[model samples]
Target chain A: MTPDPAAASAPGVLVTGAAEEEVLAAVVVALRRLCAGGAELHLRAPPVLDASVADRAGYSTSFPHLLGAVSRGGAATDLVLTPAACYHVYPLFEGRVLAAPAEVSVLADCHRQEATTERGRLRSFRMFETVRLGGAEDCLAWRDDRLDRLGHWMEALGLPAERRPANDPFWGRPGRLLASAQRADRLKWELSADVADGVRQAVVSVNHHKEHFGAAFGIRTADGEPAHTACLGVGLERLLLALHHAHGPTQERWPTHVRDALGLTRSCTN
Target chain B: MTPDPAAASAPGVLVTGAAEEEVLAAVVVALRRLCAGGAELHLRAPPVLDASVADRAGYSTSFPHLLGAVSRGGAATDLVLTPAACYHVYPLFEGRVLAAPAEVSVLADCHRQEATTERGRLRSFRMFETVRLGGAEDCLAWRDDRLDRLGHWMEALGLPAERRPANDPFWGRPGRLLASAQRADRLKWELSADVADGVRQAVVSVNHHKEHFGAAFGIRTADGEPAHTACLGVGLERLLLALHHAHGPTQERWPTHVRDALGLTRSCTN
Candidate 1:
């Protein structure tokens, strides 16, 4: 019997076997190269973040529907499962003034309470993120550059993906305005690919936070202005799912170019 | 200013730099070699576990004080941040009968709500676990064999540690009996090392569960008997903390043998 991808390991949990792990490693290497230079890789981040930090990030208020809290005996604790990887990076520079642009690469096991159990909508997932922080122009420029590169990376991997304007699923009516404003400001863009039969999902998200976190955390730019931030996150599991959907669940048969792009050498069985 | 390891990245989060990452990779390689053959490596698992799984594992009943629940708002969700890596392994074999012994190596970001926050007692930590499930004789034999090998591995790494009888922090009065019984039966052993000044913490835990998980999850051996289970877990960050305490904080200044054992070549700098 085949293992249910979501429940194979645990609910909303996707466990990677040898072949999948190889592909993920290759993908990460490719991503780091694509990021070029000056990116510091923070190999691990806590799966949980402080509740106050989450509140300051406006996550609890902006997307309460997707939030998950850590508790003891059904009573709320001061911690929450990290909703995003970049959340860990921002707090590291709290109340600090950056002399130059900072780019940090982080990988975190992120959690979200999903209402759906679709192929790509996992409750728990791995987020491969790169966060850039500095002046507004630098952050926005980096976001734009990485967005295009990520779109091209997907194409190079033989994934039929599109880069499109997007918005977070903010909750309620006020959220609707926020979503509208986000789109109007071009604050978010996603690289989406089909992970099921005609069911497309966003595998890569490029977000620009215009002083939202900087103002909240008191991170200032060289000129004493609130530092702007941008992040690019790749949902590793969803990307694997997309690859499986596109290439018959087997990596050997994938196009040669795609394999080379991902550094999946012929000898790399595992 | 040095960042507080606990709060550097986030509360209970330990972020690894380039050098630390190198050491960890080397350590994993050595552990895998020590495990020998017939081991399947599961590279990733969900940070959260289903509440039912936790209940069946007796984790909540035994260690209620250390349990962390995943909730939405203040209400409990069906999920809990995984307390251990082996919890993810059992569900995979649910209702299955194994023809041969199974050995699975898994790495998961585990969480615990400890009453204290010290260098080794992290709220969130990485657990590198290998679970063996089969006949009682095979399980216990494998547990004992691996326990000694792990102890030797720590010694080879130049960490002064001790392997001693240990018991889970079972809850309440009835739990005391369970702890005493466990100790009397020699069911649990830990490799404890000094993580701080006079603070010795358990960096590795080896436990044998005689038919506990197998019966709960309906797993059976070839003879149709409940499969026995045993697990060996290395608290990766704690080991790192221990290494820092034993050797100097700088990997370059560590004993040549220790650095060589960890594959931290002098030329290998972050």
Candidate 2:
């Protein structure tokens, strides 16, 4: 499991255990099942994003101050570290027409320069994401299905989680309005659980980008309409923290409900 | 599974299916078993490392031109994105005395600015590392045990792998000498496999730092002797590429032996 980035005592260090390994495995398998048979591939978005593309995608407008940039043969503002996992997928589909809705999943560490560094508020965090792209209605339906499936999985795992309207940590005064609008439009929903030290945090999210990415990347549906996109992502470290709070420091002492949900086997460990 | 960074056909992307999930899970469990029931905890190193630490760790000496620095607060060179997964462990042990031999494991993405973007050389790649710190003789023994265990895992997975003396892509003429010395001392041993496009690449490395890390970080063993350290790490993306090369593109089509070693169960995926 990933470590708490904000915990000053343990900031930016990962410590994993047997139960953590099991949960990580269980999470990956469950997410794959939700992908509806995705062809697994690996991706690493250029750690630095193209400033112009990010600008078109509302990155600089949303959080101009938080970008982590590199001096890699571009203007100072030409590139910034990617802020989101799904963003990279859109670029790959640039100018492409989908034959059908495609589902892709990624397990990668995302970076952000946040104002807060509280334990668990990681600067770089591990995430397992399932991203679906296609028709507007199909994407929406898939999002709904996944949201429901995630709820069921967590319930079986004995992780007390609640899905509620949420907003990204967008920046500044303008960001406040954007956040509120996002909440009002119900563009995002997070499955939040109590984590280390009884602090509440969002462990999973179901996000719909409507036509933002499709228009920005010039991606279209099979019928030549702007593609709709929805992404479901689980914060691996946060999930482990929630499990630790619920089951104890490790998985060995986890309750039968939790253990059953993880569905661990002897082959998984002794 | 992640793709090769250098491969233009699938640059900077990771994809996985049910079988791949099983493989990753299997690898983790296998590694843990090799740890001989490591009573160790997981740690997450801060993603952004202090530039001075990287400098002192001989990163600048090794690759002077390929550093990824952040323009966020402080001077241009004060901080940088972490380039190696094991570097973080050494700093944490600074000014500390180990009661006994200690071992830690990390699963994190390491950054490098590779001049050549080959299909298999990822600029930002994920690494799973096991770092052992203790007496010179004990650490060496542990390192030997790990190297042998790794060989067995690769064979069991049906990957034709060979261990050979290796050198880092050190920079310039002076760095060339360093690389030669490293190989001469048998400091770095890589398990090479034929990956993407039948190119032989390194997937695992067992590195013995001797007292380098201990001396740099001021870490002393129980008897006040500078500790010796060794790191065993797997480049997950490269391994995945090798698996794809040998087992075919989709994990579903992989051989029974491959699937079995992954310990795939219906419970893991239907």
Q: By TM-score, who's the top model here?
A: 1
Q: Which stretches in model 2 have alpha-carbon errors above 4 Å?
A: A1-15, A31-56, A70-82, A98-100, A137-163, A172-177, A196-198, A264-270, B1-21, B34-56, B71-79, B141-163, B172-174, B196-198, B246-270
Residue-level lDDT tens digits of model 2 in B52-83: 77877878667866666766432253456667
Candidate 1 lDDT score at position A50? 80
List, residue by residue over B148-265, the lDDT tens digit for candidate 1: 8888888988876788999998999999999999999999999999988999999989999999999999999989999999999999889988999998789889888897776666
Q: What's the lDDT for candidate 2? A: 0.70
What is candidate 2's lDDT per residue for A111-229, written digit by digit as tens? 56665655467656667777788888888888888888888787777786898988887888988998998899888989988886658888889988888889887889878888988
Candidate topping lDDT: 1
The runs of at least 3 residues in candidate 1 whose Cα sits more than 4 Å from the true structure, single-residue gaps closed, are A1-7, A40-43, A266-270, B1-11, B40-43, B263-270
lDDT of 1 at A217: 91
Weakest ten-residue segment in model 2 chain A by summed lDDT: A1-10
